[model samples]
Target: METDLVIVGGGPAGLSAAITATSYGADVILIEESFSLGGQLRQQTQLHANLPSKFFAERGTSLVKRLTSQLETPNLKILRNHTMIGAYKNGHIGVTNGKTTFEIEAKKNIIASGAAENAWIFPGWTLPGVMTAGAAQILLNREFVYPGKQVMMIGSNSFALEVVKQLYECGISVQAIVEASETILSRDQALLSMCKKNNIPFFLNSTIESVSGSGHVEKMTIRTSEGMMEELEVDLICTANGFSPILEAFQIMSCDLTHSEVLGGWLPTYSVNFQTSNPSVYLAGNAAGITSLGSILLTGEIAALSALESLQFISERDSNRKKAALWEELYQIETFFNKDTMLARLELVKHYHSERGLPLPDFVDPLKGEMLFG
Candidate 1:
């Protein structure tokens, strides 16, 4: 089949781009790997904010549904269970289900594959009972199951703390939240204070020495600051060190990629419009870098505008106008969030700024986003 735009991920970026592109009078198809969509937000407990409280209790799933439903335009098609594997020079894409590989030709593409959890190696990282923070969240949100009755939560960032809340809501017990850093990152200061108030000790400058269990995780041994050891008997250990974007596809496509530890690893260089060095292709959302739903949606719209311009569906001047307007909106939202302490743990915590009075680049590649945005 052929399309004007092929969005290769159904997460926030791809979905947002699809909606915007279709509204702009382009035929768009969004292919997602998993059966369900919503990307990372699907696993989150609540919508967080770095700005003034707008919609506090808005569930992540609810936002996904509203966006999905709104984007169900006749020109927009969503294909779930489609895993895109290759992008050809002519802009054709190869996608696979278990038994079939389908080729779809498109004038332009958006890579929004999102990100995967980062698994830090430890003595017991490979244990069966060990799971990423996102994985633990999936069980709780989608399957309506908790990781364990009593669990040892590892990592001290937003993802880890969010898991703690999820566990509590599910009526599971948290033995302790272990942090490698001296300070923990959480959205709610009240929650952090409560943890401390309840004497749920937060380990500072500690690491898991080993996890011991025969078949499943039974206990975890950790090294503390004073050269002392602590052990907790828990059925599962949820580790949330953060995430690494799924940028390997860009490498395979020979797109110019740079390593930005700030961007959270290897990332492709793309215009503000999400265009890679290969003008016809684009990337949006977490696939570019870890960002919230709002940012992802904005990136998707900008990317679509650029892609249409590349294909001559939209005039450069028109596309530029749209791009500028969207960017200004994004800037407003981002700037407002910069002062919010809740998102200190998020990767795009600060606005993109340059020192030495040098102006920032017009477009940032994925690799450079980490350094520039980090």
Candidate 2:
């Protein structure tokens, strides 16, 4: 197959990119490994804060619906159940649908392949009743099946808190929330208040030493902050350590990568426009970095606009103006919800530009009235 643009992943970011590219008269092919789009958005049951809007909120499902509704144009080709196996430097993409393998030759490609959940390794972690928090979420929210009667969460970040909230709403018992840090990692005060209101027990500065059961998880040994070991009986164990970007295709394409703990792990080095070292390739959404949903959506559009500008489908001047507006909106969202991450991104951009012997743009720190670079 030959196309103007090929998008990997049919999640929110890829969908946004496809819609934007197709609207601008680009023939696009979107490939997804799943039978349907939406990706993790389908499993999300909580309300997400809208971009640059303090009072407005939208559910993930609603956002998915809104995006998918706009993809009826003939310029867009949907390839569900197809996985992108290889991305080559020569603009050839290898894809397979379990039965047949094929290749696509594209002028430009956008990788919004998203992120994978990180595993928290422990003794007996491979037991049948032990699973990731994401798995537990899909079972509870999407499949309407309860994972267990008593659950122990291994992390206390935003993702873990959201899943805990859902588990509570479903009338399941959360035995305790265990965090290796000294305090809860989640910055959401509202969720923290909910945990307090419900009298949920939290084990801070703690680690699960081991879990044991004959056929499944039956009990766990936790080392508390006081250096005392405590044993708890639980039917299920959900680990929500964190997530890392899925960079298999990016590595295959040999895009320059850098490590940033704030950005969720190893990610491609790209400009503010989301163009990577490989000019023909771009990245968006979680593939770029783990960030707010609103910012992730904007990245897709920005990357699409950059690709369109390269193809001369859109004028560079017009693309710059649109991208500027998108960047401002993204900054606003990140400043509100992810100030530290936004600062880290600015630093990363500066480093990328400096390493290439390019002039660094002047950057002002949002939190402090000070110049970061000149």
Candidate 3:
């Protein structure tokens, strides 16, 4: 199949891009590897904590519904259960829907492929009762199945905190929260207060030495900060160590990449417009970097606008205007919820400028609300 634009991922970013592009009369194809759209939003059961009042307290599923509702434009085609396998330099991409493989040629492509959960490996991580926080979330919110009767979280990120609250709501016991850091990593004070109110024990400066059971996880040994060993009985171990961007497709497409620890590892080097080193390719959402949900949605629309401008489907003047507004909102979200990501992006742009021998004065740091190169 061929189209004007091909967006890989049906999550918030991809969905937003498709909706924006299609509304402007672009022939858009949205491919999702799952049977349904919404991606991680389907399993999210908490309100957005750091967004402005307009978006704050809104559920992820509600955002998914809002974006998907505008997807009925005639210029848009949805391909569910399709996986992108290969991306060629000539604007052709290989895709498969489990049984048959096909290729789709497009004038422009956007990868909002999102992220993968980071693994926290310990001596019994491979056990049956051990899983990622995302897995437990899907089980509880989507499948309506309980991951375990008594769960112990292995990380203290916001994702893990939210999952613990969900478990508490479902009447499941959260044995404890173990963190290898000196302090709790999650910045959401509300969730932290909730955990405190419920009296969930927190083991700071601690590490899971090992977990043991006959065939599944039944007990875990923790190395506490005081150089002491402690044991806890728990049926499940959930790791919420955060996520890394999925950059396999970007690499296959030959987009230039750079590493930033703050951005969650290697990501495609993108411009202010979200265009990658490869002119026809763009990135959005977690595929660009780890960020809040509001920023992810803005990146999607900005990427679509950039692609549309490149295709001449939208005038440069109009595109710039729309993107300026989107960038403002993006910076607001990042400043309030993802300051680390903002700094990472500044560093990424500096590297991009240096590699291309572009003068620094031509670039501005919108995230910092100041001229970084002047």
Best by TM-score: 3
Cα TM-score per model: 0.86, 0.94, 0.95
Residue 364 lDDT in candidate 2: 25
Model 2, CA-based lDDT: 0.87
Question: Candidate 1: misplaced stretches above 4 Å?
Answer: 50-57, 89-91, 187-190, 335-374
| Superposed model 2: Cα runs more than 4 Å off | 52-56, 359-374
lDDT of 1 by residue, 95-197 (tens): 8887898888887788888888888788867888799878888898878876778877888775677677778767777888888877776655767765766
The root-mean-square deviation over C-alpha atoms between each candidate and the true structure, in angstroms, is 5.2, 2.4, 2.1
Scanning candidate 1 in windows of ten residues, the lowest lDDT window is 341-350
Pairs in clash, predicted candidate 3:
none
What local lDDT score does residue 330 receive in model 3, on the 0 to 100 scale? 75
Error of 1 at 18 (Å): 0.4
The stretch of ten residues in a row with the least summed lDDT in candidate 3 is 360-369
Between which residue pairs do clashes occur in model 1?
Answer: 262-370, 263-370, 267-367, 268-366, 269-365
Worst 10 residues of 2 by lDDT: 362-371
